[model samples]
Target: MTDTLATAEIESTIRSLEDARYAAVVAGDIEGFAAFAHPELLYTHSNAAVDTLDSYLEKLRTGFYVYHRIDHPVHKIVVVGDTVLVSGEMRADITAGGVRKQLANSALAVWVRDGGRWLLLGYGPTVIPGAI
Candidate 1:
């Protein structure tokens, strides 16, 4: 059975991984990106597109979506059983389908603990209602 309570230490790990994920995307580090994602990630974007882990990684690697830089602030992490949920604000410079796209977002990510390691199992990021 999975532990329902995550220690403050575990919570710290969660935050660090969140930082690392955005960093890896900006760096275009394929291995790092893959390491951060779980086998069955279901990600929904602010633009209303949805992807599984493989599809998402493929698009990133191919420049279908280019992540230039990312900043996450006001993030909160909570744990329930083996699942970790994160909610936050995101700002970034990005391109989608060869067009520069707005990047301000309100994001949520779900990470699952598997074999004692945390892997991002899902992501949903909604665009901020209005922007420059």
Candidate 2:
């Protein structure tokens, strides 16, 4: 496929993934979140903590962390071959460790096309310190 066509395809797929993630968070669907992630997906936070998909889910389940909603908007997406990158902003309403709070952040995601599926390989986010 031509680079332009490939980029378009990847961008569409990435947009779908982003939408699904937003919905899953609002629904507090762990299964849905798992489907959006690769088995070994590496997620990094602004604080530099990294977690595999499984580990991240474990923290959510075991800690009784409930993510009720995530208001994230994709600003831009760029694709080069098998790698796709996206930049966006997000606001999340979460309940964790007995505290209910809302937070906002800027996020970036990197996806790789493995086989025929676009898998989330890496994601990072910077918390907007005082934005709620």
Work out the TM-score per prediction.
0.91, 0.86
* Tens digit of per-residue lDDT, candidate 2, span 48-81: 7888898888876675567777788899998877
- lDDT for predicted candidate 2 compared with the true structure: 0.81
Consecutive 10-residue window with the lowest summed lDDT within model 2: 59-68
Q: Cα lDDT for residue 19, model 1?
A: 88
Worst 10 residues of 1 by lDDT: 1-10
What digit string (tens of lDDT, one per residue) describes model 1 on residues 75-126? 6888877888999988888898999865888999999999888999999988
lDDT of each: 0.86, 0.81
